[model samples]
Target: MAPTGIVLLDTYLPTSDEIAAILPELIGDMFEPPDGIAHLEQLRLTAMGRYFRMFGDWNPNPVSAPKLFVRPGDPLREHHREVAWRAGWPLPHHSADVGGNHFTMMSEGAATTAEAISRWIDALRH
Candidate 1:
């Protein structure tokens, strides 16, 4: 994105490897069509192809304004957090281990996600 404003990333993974890495977990965790694997294959292909086409390079770019990176609260899943930071994406000035996985953070953990984001923004305003 054209860096210009405040940002809140909920497990903002930007690479195919990141997507692929979590595929195993996602296979059974999501509500998909009977052809779940097929659907995921399409998603996987997009991560590998369409993502780069739309986003330019994998290189990290500078981001201005306040930033926050919130992730699933699962302690065992901490490695994703580590991987995220190492991707050269603009580092979040603030970080948190919130609730739910990458996708659940939007649905099952939507409330938690909202609260976390709200707190982040409130802190930024102060």
Candidate 2:
């Protein structure tokens, strides 16, 4: 989705450990190598024990602006989009299909996905 105001552009969320690891490749536009390193450092600063504990306590209730743009779109993307559409504002954009791979893209398709995003952003700006 387009950002609501002049300040925020989009939200980048990496939900699982595997996805987080591949995130640098998937969403390279958002950060430089240094930024990725910094994010890793920040993640390390948090205690793993505390992080694991939150899994059981997680709750579904929330009230806030919708976060947009989920990457590495797979079957799960459509599922979540359906849920979000029912709940409130549907997500604005999903990651490119990339030849339907749940795992990392295979060279040509990855480039295709990247190009798609570039075009999408350019279109949004104009």
Candidate 3:
């Protein structure tokens, strides 16, 4: 089923250079997966290799659907909101800034995120 609206929670749509810079770090993060996870390292390496191969030619297709960008107030990745706006993605009446960085936002700021989403959905239904 097609979604009526989308809630983007600190999503990253990286440029080629950004991908190149972060690819190694991403692979590093996948290392040392918990014990008993068979072939995890190989799987991560394979995926990273595939992503690297695709990065140079990557392009973000235009999205027509309404979107709500939930930005974290912490300042590291807040630029993502502007990126979405510049790409012409439609935003809700107000962009929500939950108080945590990208990773922590989901866990620490989950309530705020949920409330913002609920408000946006309620507004749409009205």
Candidate 4:
């Protein structure tokens, strides 16, 4: 289904280096490749390079869809909250505190995140 709303979870809008740093941790012993870890590393670097190059200089474009910024209760919450406010998303911009750090928000905080999403979607439906 097409997305009715957008939920950003502990998102940093990471730079190439930041994205690159997570590659090893994320891909460790996960996949087998002919070229080994070098392949994954190259892929990560290339993809992040292109992604940052394309969107790095860009700002949020105006859209009609609703946007929800979900920030964990962490040091970066205020930073992301500010970013969401300044993002100039659609008129019905919203924010929610999922009550965990970035990683935990995805794991331990999944239920809260899901509930927030459900509530947002229900509101949109109405």
In order, what lDDT does every prediction score? 0.56, 0.37, 0.57, 0.58
Backbone collision count in every prediction?
0, 2, 0, 0
Which numbered prediction scores highest in TM-score against the true structure? 1
Root mean square deviation (Cα) for candidate 4: 8.2
Model with the higher lDDT, candidate 1 or 4:
4
Q: What C-alpha lDDT does candidate 1 achieve relative to the native structure?
A: 0.56
Where does model 2 exceed 4 Å of error? 1-95, 106-108
**By the lDDT metric, which is better: model 1 or model 2?**
1
**Residue-by-residue lDDT tens digits, candidate 3, 29-122:** 4564322222346676787567657654565565666678777666323454443222112334246677765445677677888888899989
Per-residue CA lDDT of model 2 for 20-87, tens digit only, reads 44444433422333221223234543543354466434433433433323233442234433332211
- Judge candidate 2 against the unseen true structure and give its global Cα lDDT, from 0 to 1: 0.37
What's model 2's TM-score?
Answer: 0.30
For candidate 3, the per-residue lDDT at 69 reads 78
lDDT of 1 by residue, 1-126 (tens): 644335455533445465555555454443352321234566675674575486544654556666666666642245656653321234656776667655566766779888988887787668
Model 1 per-residue lDDT at 38: 33
Cα lDDT over the full model 3: 0.57
Alpha-carbon lDDT of model 4: 0.58
Worst 10 residues of 4 by lDDT: 82-91
Q: What is the TM-score of each candidate against the true structure?
A: 0.57, 0.30, 0.55, 0.55
